[model samples]
Target chain A: MNHDAYPDSYIRGILNSVKTIAMVGISPNTSRPSYFVFKYLLGRGYRMIPVNPGQAGKDILGQAFYAKLSDIPEPIDMVDIFRASEHVMPIVQEALTLKPKPQVIWMQLTIRDDAAALLAEQAGIKVVMNRCPKIEYGRLSTEISWIGVNSRTLSSKRAQILGKGVQRMGLGTPKD
Target chain B: MADAERVPGFATLAIHAGAKPDPTTGARITPIYQTASFVFDDVDHAASLFGLQAFGNIYTRIGNPTCAVLEERVAALEGGTAGLAVASGHAAQVVVMHALMTPGDEFVASKKLYGGSINQFNHSYKNFGWNVVWADPDDIASFEKAMTPKTKAIFIESIANPGGVITDIEAVSKIARKAGVPLIVDNTLATPYLCKPFDYGANIVVHSLTKFLGGHGNSIGGMIVDGGNFNWTRKGQYPMLSEPRPEYSGIVLAETFGNFAFAIACRVLGLRDLGPALSPFNAFLIINGIETLPLRMQRHSDNALAVSEWLSKRPEVLWVSYPGLAGDKYNALAKKYVPKGCGAVFTFGLKGGHEAGVKLVSNVKLFSHLANIGDTRSLIIHPASTTHKQLSDAQKVQAGAGPDVVRLSIGLEDKDDIIADLEEGLTAA
Candidate 1:
C-alpha cells in the first residue's frame, strides 16, 4: 500500500477484516493515546492483547498484559505500534517471529518507519505507518461525520431508516 | 522529541483541541460553516455518505463544522470519548433518554435536580412511557433500592441546581455498576473546570451549555458526553447500542463505534429524528465562551463563596445553602469532587418568608431579576413564583423551591458591589 496517499478502499479492507489487535507499548495510564486506542478497539468488539514489558503481569481494563508478541497464545491479526519510530524496527522484527504470523502492522499517529515497513512488506505483511486505526475505523464507518469532520466520502443514497427507533453509525455490523 | 507523547493540559485543550487553523483563510478562530448542505464530489461519494460508508458534512441540521469543534472541545474537557451538541439543555436530556430508554423502560434519578428536569422527567417522560424513580441523592442506599431489572440508567447532578448540593457521584456509580446501568451525571452547575464526572466513574455527562459553559447569557445549548466506560453490550440490556441497527444495514453501534457509540447513538438516532440541532451561529458563540471557562469559573466560585459567607450573617436571611460554605452538609463532598469550589449558583431563605422572598427579588438593583443562571451579570429568582410555579406546593419544596427560598447565580462582579446589592435587597425585604 502507498504510504503517502493510500486509497480509502485499502483502509476499509483492513478495518473490516481485522478481528484481534496486539497493541505493543500499551500503557496503563488512561491519558495516553495508546490506552485510549486499546480501550476503543476492545469496545468495538475487537479482542485486544496488550504488550508491555513493564506491565507484563498486570491487567489493563481486565485484559492480561503480555511481555512480548510471542508471549500471546493466539495469532494476532494486526500489530498496532504505539511505540516511538525508533522502536518500530524491533517490534516489526519480533512480530515476524509469530507462528501464524500477523497479516498487518499499523503504526499509531505521527509514527513512521520506512525501513521497517519495507521489511514487513517483503515478508508478506501489509503495513500502515503514521496512521491511527481508531481514527480510520471512525472515518470509514461515517461515525466521524456526526461531528462534521470532512471524511471526504459521500453517497447519493439517503441514510436507510433502520426502524421506528434511532439509526446507528452508518457503519455495518461487525461480522464474526 | 520527548514532548511527542505529552498530553496537553486542561487549559491548552480548552483552546486547541479538535481544532486547527483554517487551511483556506488561516483563520485564527473557527469559522462558522453556515450553509445547510455540503456538496458531494460524485454519485459514488454521495452514496457512500448516506450508506454510512463514508463521513462528510451532508447537512447542517445533521452536523455542522462549527458545532463539531464545540463538541470536541467539550468532550476533551470532560475527559469523555465523544460529545453531541444540541439546541438546548432540555433537548440534551431528551436525546440522552431517547437513546437509553424505549417505551416502558425505567431510570433512577436523584430528587435534587433542576426543577425543569424534574418536570421533564415526571411529566414529559411519563408520556413516552419512560418511568422515572426518584431517589434521594444524599442516601446512597436510596439509589440502590430504586434499582430494578428495568432500570437502564442512574441520573444525578454534580453540584445540583438551586441548593448547590454536591452529589456523592462515586458512591452512586458503584450502585450503577452493580445494577449494570449507566451513571449519567448532569454537570451543568459544576462545569468540567470544577469537576469532571468521568474521573469518578460516570458513564455519561450531560450539560446545559445555557449555563456556565456558555458563561454568558447570549446562547442556549446543551451537550451529552460519553465517558466510554459502560459495557452497553452486556446482557443485551440496551438494544439501542447492542442490537443490530436496521437503518444502517443492521450495523450494531456498540460493536462498531466502541466507547463513542453512545454519543453516535444520540446523534444518528435521537438528534436526527428529534430535530434539535444546535445552530452553527450559536455554536460559534459558545465556542468562544468556552475559551475563558477556567478564568470565569474560578472567579465565579470566589465571588459566590464571599456572598454566601455574607448572607449567612444577615439577620434577614433564614439560611444560606451553598456547599462551599465550610459547615454546609455537602461541604465535604464538595471538597472531594468539586475542590475547585462548589460553583456559582446557590439558594437562600428569608426570615420574613414568602412575601420577603418576592420583595427581595424585586428590590435588588445591580442583580438582574431573571430566570437564567451562570450569566456574567448577577441574577436572582424567586423560583416558586416563576420556574416552579406549575408544581404543587409540596413538589416545589422538594425541588428546593420553597415559598420563602430565593436563588442567586453569582456572577464575576466586584464582591463588594454584589454584597451591597444583596444588602439593599434584604433591607427592602
Candidate 2:
C-alpha cells in the first residue's frame, strides 16, 4: 500500500472541506451497493447531490436529483461515479468544464479510464483510483478490528503475537 | 515457450484439452491427489522446490495437480496464457490488484459492476491502502479522464452485474492502451462464449465462478486469467510483474514465464501469501459448468430478450431494462460489444413502487427469490428492500434501486414458465 499516494493525514484534513458530493448513479432502492455507500457518506453528514436522469425531478433521501453533474446549483466538491467506465469520461469532462472544477474525481469499483485521470491530474486535481472513500474513512481512523482471538489486546505482546479475535475484525461498527 | 496443444472451440477444450491419461496410472480424469505435501527426489530436489528453482507442489494450499487442470482448462476457455483459481471472487480481485497497485496507487474501473466488488474495492481494500477510481465503460473518454500518475490499471466487466449492461470493450481498451496501462476486464457475466475481453484488448481477466460458471449454484470459486500480452516492463508502470522478487530467488516473472507470468504471480505470490486457494471439489463443478457454457449462454440471452420484450408490453409494468431491447439506452453499446447475445440478467419495474415490486417477487413461483444471477434457474430479487436495505433513501435512488425495480435472472427453464410466473407477479402488482 502506497501511503505517499494518499496521505491519510491530508485526507483527514480535507474531510470537513467537502460539503457536497454529486453522486452520478444514485439509486432509490435501499439494497444496491451504491445505496449503502451513499448512506454511509450521508451519515457522515456530507450533502449528496444525486444525479440520475431517470429521477431528475424527484427528491431522494431529502436530496434532489439533477440530470448531470453540471446541472447542480451548488459547487460539487467531488464527482462520485456510480455509473459504468464508458459513462465516466463525459462526467469527468463535464466536471473539468465546471467553472470550479471538483477537487476530486472518485470512480467506483471496476470503473477506470486513463484520459480522464490525466485530465484531472493536469488540472491539478487529486485522483483516487479503484478505492472507495467510505472504506478509507473507516480503516485509517476507525477502530477496524483485526482477526483471531487467542484473546489479545491492542499493542500488547499477546495482541502482536496472536492478533485479536474474529469478532474484532470490522466489528460492523462505524469507527469514523 | 513450453509446448501445449491449442484446441479450438470451447466445449472441445473444456472436456479434452488440458488433461491427458495419467503418465503413472493411465487414469482418464485428472485425479485429485488428497495429500499435504509431495515427496522429493532428494534433499537437492527439496531445496530446489523450496528455492523456487522448479514448479512443484510443496503444500495443498499453494498448488495441487487436480486444481492445475481447472486452471489450464479455464485458461483455454478464456483464451489466455494461464489461469489461477482462488477461494472466491473477492480473493481473485485482491490478488490481481497486488500485481498492479502499490498501496494508494489507483486503478480505473467500471461503475456498473457486481455489488460485492463495489463493497470490496470501496470498503475492504481501503485498509490495504488501494483506491478505486470509477469510470464509465460505455464512454472511453471517461476512463481516459480518470487516469493519473498513480493509476495502474483500467477495470470493467464484459457485462456488468445485475443490470446486464454491455461495455464497449474495444473503445475502453483503446483508452487503456493510450494511457499505457493494462486493461482488466471481469468476464464473469459474459463468460467466454458471449464475449472474450482479451480479443478486445483486455490484458487480464477475472471471474466469479460461483455464478454462471458453476451453473448448479453449488460452489463458490473464482479465476484470474492473463493474456500474457501486456508488457509490464514499461517505465515505472508494474514493477511487481517486471521486477525480481526477493522471495523467489530474485528472478523476474516476466523474464522467465513471459506472458503467463502474471497468472503465475497471482498464483505463487498473491494466492500463496493470502491462502485463498480454491477447493478441488468446486473446481470440478466449474468444469462441469463450462461444458455447457456455450449452450447455456445462448438460451440465457434468447430467454432474456424474450422476457424483456414481454415486460415492456405488460400494462402493469412501468419500465423494462434490458440491453437487447431496441429502445433501451444501452442497446447500441450491446450490439457493438455483445453481438452474439446480451446476458440473462435484467431489471424491470412494477407500476406501483416498493409494494408492487415486493408483491411481484413474492408471487412468482418459477423465479427463485434469491440475490444471485447467472443461474440455470430463473431468479428474482427486489433490491430496494433486500440488497439496498442498508442504504438511506438517498443512496438507494442513486443505485438504480427504486421502489418499483425488480431484477430477474432468466434461467434455462422454458421461457414461457418464467414469463408466466412473472406475468402473475406483475398482475398481482
Candidate 3:
C-alpha cells in the first residue's frame, strides 16, 4: 500500500474492520498524546489494549497493559505504534511473530519508517504511516470536522448512532 | 487502485459538515436536543464524563447535540480546529477573553468595530477587570504601540462594521505573533464565505450568528472558532489551557487537546462557568441558515456592490465607504482579503448630515429601518441615531459612524428595486 496518501475509503475500511487495537508506547500520564488517543478510541467503543513495558502490570482507563505485542493474550486486529520511528522496526517484527498476526500496522503521527512498512506489506499485513488513528476516526466519522478541522471526506448520508447517544460512521460500507 | 482523494468544497461542507440524518428517528434534519441534561449509562460513565476523561454531552449549558452541529459546521467552514457556540456575539467575546485574560489583563482592539462591541469592551468588560486599549486598524503601527506586558490578546474585525473597511489581518497577525498573543478577528460581517480569518493568520475567529449566518436575522447566536494555530502552552502565558484545572482532575487542556485546546478551554472554563449557552432551537436555525450561506452571501455581496456604485454617483451621497468600489480607501485590502465582493453592509455619507441620515432611514420603503444587517430584506440604520448613539462625537467618527454616515445592509433584493428604494430615500433626504 502506498504511504504517501491513503484514500478516505481505505482509512475508513481499516477503522471499521478493526475491533481490537493494541496501542504500543501509550503513556500513563493523562496529558500525553498517546493517553488521550487511547482514551478517545476507548470512548468510541473500540476494545483498546494498551502496550507499555513501563506500566505493564497496571491498567490504563481500566484496560490491561502488555509489555509487548507477543505477550497480549487476545488477538489484536491492529497494532497502533505511538513510539518513535527508530523503535517501530522491532515492534513490527515482533507483531509478525504473533500466532495470529495482526492484520494492520499503524504508525502514529510523525513516526514513519518505510523499511518497516515494506516488511509489513511483504507479510501481507496492511501498513499505515505518519497518521493518528484518533484523528482519522474523527475525520471519517465527521466528528472532528464539527469543531472546524478539515475532514477531507464528505458524505450526505446520515450518521449512524449506536446504542446510547453516541454517533459513529462505519468505513467498510457506504450505508454507515 | 489508489483513487485520488477529493476534498469537499465549501458548499458541500456548509450543508453536510456537522449534520447527519437522525440516528434513531432517521430525521433528515438535525433535531433540537432540547433537554437540559443527558443521561449517563452507569456510574463509571458518569464519572468518566465528569472527570473529562470522555467526550459526551453532560449539560446543555456546555454542549448540546444541536449546538454541536452548529459549532462544527461553522468551524468546518472557517477551516479551524474546533468551535464553541454561545448565546450571542458578545458572549463569544466574553468567553474568549475569560480564557485568555485574568482580572487586570488587557487586550488591544481596533477602534473600527461594531458600535455595540465598542460599548461592551469599554464598559461591560471593565466590570470583569479586563482592560481594552484601542488601536486604529488603518495604522498598523498602532497595534504594536498598544501592546504591553499585560496584553493577553489582540482583537480586530475581518471587515469593520457599518463602514465596510477591510482590516489588514496578516500585518496585525504578525504584530500579535511578535507580542506572543493570539489575534482574534470578528468575522461577523464578512463571514467565512467571503473572508476566512484563519487563512489570514488570525488565531481565533468570532461571529454574531444573528446576522448572515442565520441569514434571516431571526435568531441571535455567536461562535468562537479556534484556528488551532497558537501555542497556548508557550511560556505558560495562558494558564487556562496550560495549567491543570482543579475541576477536571488536573487535566492540562493544551497538552491533551493539542491544536483545539483554545476552543475546549472556552467551552469548559468560560462557557461552563459564565453561563451563556446557545439554545438548541437557535442552533438548528443557524444550521439551516448556514446550509445556504454560500448562496446567500454571494447574492448579498453582488447586490451591495451594484448599490454602492450607484450610490457613489448620486448627488445626495457625499461619499460611499464601500471597499468594493474601485477608488475606496480600503479597496486594496478588500481585494486581498475578501476577493469575493465587499459583503452587504457599507456606510455612505449624506450631504445633509445627521438629520438627513435619519430621514433617509425613515423614508426607505423596502429597506427595514433597523439596527441589524445581513437580512434577506435590505436594512438601513443611521448609527449616530441608533447603534452608535451612546458613543461621543470623536468616537462616532473614529468608528465610522459619523453624523453624515448612513449604513446600509444591502439585502438579496433585486438591484433595481434596492436602488429605487435607496433613490427614494435619498430624494426624501
Candidate 4:
C-alpha cells in the first residue's frame, strides 16, 4: 500500500514525520532483505534499533545494538521487524505493552497475519501488511539531496513515486 | 528474626499485627474510643498522663488507641521501627523534614522525581527557609558534589514516577550515611512488595497512601516510617532530636523516646503541632486496600510485562521503556532490586511523534486517559501536553518526557485484550 491510498491526514501526517527507523532484525549478512533494506533506510537517515539478542549488545554502523527493544533506553519511536509470522505475535504483544506504544506495526515486506494485525488493530494500534517502515519513510517523505534537482519531480517523472511533495527538514533550525 | 516475625506476611499482619484485642475490652475488632478527653483517676494521674509518667491516652488529637493501631500496622508493613500516619503524604514530608532539619538546613534530592516534590522543594519550602539541592542520581558525584555543611538528608524515590527508573537505593543510602545524614526514600511507586526501602539502608520511608497501597483507589492518605537507624544523640547534629522541644516542656525526643519511639515523637509532637493527622475513614480504606496488595501487584506486573513485550515489536512504535524488557537499560537494575516484580507504570514513544501520539491517545478504547497511576483499571497520559505541560522544552526533556511520549499504567486485564486496545491506539497514533 502507498501513502495516497488513505487521504486521512492523520495517518499521512504520521508517515511524513517518521524518517530513519531501527528495524530490530536487520541481518548483516547480505543474503537477507533486512540487510539491503537496512542499508537503504540508513542511506535515508532513519536509525535502526538492532534486536538480535545474540549480536545485540554490540555496535552496528557505530550505533549500539540492543538484544531487544527495551534495551535501547534513550529514545526509539518505531520498531520494524523481519522475523517470522509466529514471531510477530510475541513482538506485537510486547510492542503494545510498551510505555508509549509504537505508532504503527508493519508486518514486513511479505509476512502478513490478519490475526496479529487484528490484535494490534483492536488495541487502536495501526498495522500495515507486507510493508516496511524504512522503505515507506524513504519513499513517502523524500526531500532528497544530490543530483541538485527536485527529487520529487524527478521521481514523479521517472519512477512515478506517489508522494505529495518534499520539504527540506531536520536542518538549520537554530539561531544565535 | 523468626519466620513469623519477618513482617508477619501481608494479610495476617495488616489486620492483627498491631493490636491484640485491647485487654480492657475483649472486642474482636479494634474499636475507636472517639472521645477527645480521657478521664484521670486523680490529680496525680492527670499530672503523670500529661507529664509522660503514664502510658495512657489523654486526648484524641494528641494520641488515640485507634491511630496507634493504624501506625503499628503501617510500621510492620514498612518494616520500620515505627510509623506515623499523617493528613497526607505531603504532610508526612513536612513533619519529618521539620523533625530532622531546622529553619536554615538543606536536603539533597534526585533530579528525576515527582513534579510535586520539585514544586515543594523550590516553592513551598523556600518560604520556610528550607533549601533543596538537586543532584543527578545517575552521576553519583553530583549528590556528593551538592552536599555542604548545612545538608541534613538525601531524598530519592525507590522507583521514580512516570519515567519508571529505579534508583540505586543502597548506593545513595551509603552516601547519606557517610555524610552523616539520613536517606529518605519515597516508596510510593515501588510500594512495599516491589521494594522495602527500609531493607535497603533507607533511614526513613514515606508513602502517599493514595496509590498502590490503597490498591482499590479508594482513599487519600500518607505515612512515614522511621527505620530507627539514625542516631540523634551521637553528636551535636540534630538539634530538634538531641535538644529540647519548647512546646513539650523541654523534652528531648531522642532522650524521651529512645530508638523506635522517635517516629512516635514526630507524631505526638510534630504532627500534633503541625496538625496533619490522618482521618480514621482514610485509614480504614487504606487498611482494606493493603489486604490484597500482593495479589494486585502480581497482576499489575504480569500485565505490564505482556504489554511491554508487545510494544517492542510494533512497526509504528518509536521505543518502549519498561525495565522488565530484556534489552532495556534498566533491566539489570530491575533484576537486581525488583526481582520479585517491577511495578506496571512505564513510558514509551510513538512512531509518528506528536500527531501519531494524539492518534494513539484518541484511539485506545480500553485504556483510560487519566492522570493518576496504580489504579486497578489501565490508564494512559501524554506527558508533554498534560502533566509536565508547565515545564519548558528543556525541562520536559530533563524530566524524561518528550512530545511523543505516552505513559501507560497497565492494569489487571487479559494480556491479549490489553495489547488489542494498544493496537487500536497505535493505529490512531
Number of backbone-clashing residue pairs for each candidate, in the order shown = 12, 70, 4, 57
DockQ of 3: 0.38
Q: What are the iRMS values of all candidates?
A: 13.9, 22.8, 3.9, 37.9
Evaluated on CA atoms against the true complex, candidate 2 attains a DockQ of 0.01
Alpha carbon lDDT at B417, candidate 1: 99
Q: Candidate 1 on A141-166: residue-level lDDT in tens? A: 54464563333333322322222322
B191-236 in candidate 4: lDDT tens per residue?
8788888888999889888888786666778888888788887556
Put down candidate 4 lDDT per residue, A66-172, tens digits, no spaces: 77776667555666778877688887777777766677776675566777778877887666766554334432332121100111111111111232322212211
Model 2 regions lying over 4 Å from their true place: A1-176, B1-7
Model 3: CA > 4 A from native? A1-5, A29-36, A39-47, A60-63, A73-75, A84-100, A109-124, A142-152, A163-176, B1-4
Winning candidate number (TM-score): 3
Ranking by TM-score: 3, 1, 2, 4
- Please give the RMSD to the true structure for each candidate, in Å: 11.8, 24.7, 2.9, 32.1
Error (Å) of candidate 1 at residue B337 is: 0.5
Identify the candidate with maximal DockQ.
Answer: 3
lDDT of 2 by residue, B156-196 (tens): 98888777677888888888888888888898888888788
Answer with 3 or 4, whichever has the higher lDDT. 3
DockQ for every model comes to 0.07, 0.01, 0.38, 0.00
Q: After superposition, how far is residue B23 of candidate 2 from its true place, in Å?
A: 3.1
lDDT of the structure predicted as candidate 3: 0.86
